[model samples]
Target: MEWGMHGWGMGLIWVLVVLFLVLGVLAFAKYLIKG
Candidate 1:
């Protein structure tokens, strides 16, 4: 209920957070591979 109060906003934030984390991991892996 508390998380649903903001509806799409909460969902959007979570999607962005997950995307950022995945990108971060990929970037780190890329950097490691390059080095």
Candidate 2:
């Protein structure tokens, strides 16, 4: 179990990816509603 091998940077990247995906879905839903 190496500490820096699976470090906070990688986890932060994944968190951002998920945040973007959630925001994308919300934007699409808003577009559909407006259309």
The prediction achieving the highest lDDT against the true structure is 1
Instruction: Mark the 10 consecutive residues where model 2 has the least summed lDDT.
Output: 1-10
Segments of candidate 1 deviating more than 4 angstroms: 2-5
TM-score of every model versus the real structure? 0.78, 0.77
Residue range 1-35, candidate 2, lDDT tens digits: 66684778788889999999999999999999999
lDDT, residue 20, candidate 1:
100
How many backbone clashes does every candidate have?
Answer: 0, 0
Candidate 1, clashing residue pairs?
none
Note the Cα lDDT for every prediction shown: 0.93, 0.92
Collision count of model 1: 0
